[model samples]
Target: MSSRYAFTKTVKELRSFLTRAYPIMKKNNPHVPILIREGTGALPRVYARYDLGQEQTCSLEGLSDKQIEETVTSLVKPTSL
Candidate 1:
């Protein structure tokens, strides 16, 4: 059996997150690819993948689409000062 079936609520939440997150994530960081993935928390995690396939996950739990848009901007920003 798939976890998707076993955890319908989680699946629903995850879907809701991705639906809202995809557009905002793309607009904020168009240069690189963004990924939304399943996580240990209530909300899904978003990742920014580098050219070499390295990934860094960020949280958007309980965040509205507008909030996600703002927050994801920060996540993809240059880590170095």
Candidate 2:
């Protein structure tokens, strides 16, 4: 997929996953930044910004396994899509 498409998909997936893990994620009065770095000739890298009192990069390397599934689930739900 293109960089923009990949980024969109990744962010959507993250949002869904976070919502499931933290029921109040959508209402967590905090601004989160999701960044995607597209490789020159390789797969894109996903990054997430977390400010749990301090800024830190979330360990999303191995955490996106469920992203596709969660994203798909959310897409099917009109209210949550």
Candidate 3:
């Protein structure tokens, strides 16, 4: 998976790739929680976590398309340190 994103070279590459991927997934499914894997707590890494309940709500609830798009976009964007 890392190789596909050209992140196989190093951990930094992997995190960068995952950071970019996160928004695409969130855009597709806004309600699901995204879990980023990292070392213990001090250091962070990118990862995906899916909850079925959240998925169901996103699918069934009345969420505007615009809102969903914005939310997903926010998720994928890099955060400030």
Best by lDDT: 1
Candidate 3 has its poorest 10 consecutive residues by lDDT at 53-62
Of 1 and 2, the candidate ahead on TM-score is: 1
* Candidate numbers, best lDDT first, in rank order: 1, 2, 3
lDDT of 2 by residue, 6-63 (tens): 6666555555565575445325534543333444434323333323443322333223
Estimate, for each residue in 1-81, the C-alpha lDDT of model 3 and write its tens digit.
744333223445445545666677779869876665444323222232233432211221223334444544554555532
The candidate, 1 or 3, that scores higher on TM-score is 1
Which pairs of residues collide in model 2?
A: none
Error of 3 at 66 (Å): 29
Clash statistics: count for each candidate: 0, 0, 0
Residue 21 lDDT, candidate 3, scale 0-100: 64
* TM-score of every candidate: 0.44, 0.33, 0.34
In candidate 3 the C-alpha lDDT for residue 26 amounts to: 75
Positional deviation of 21 in candidate 1, in angstroms?
7.0
| lDDT (Cα atoms) of all candidates against the true structure | 0.61, 0.45, 0.44
Per-residue lDDT value at 56 in model 2: 23
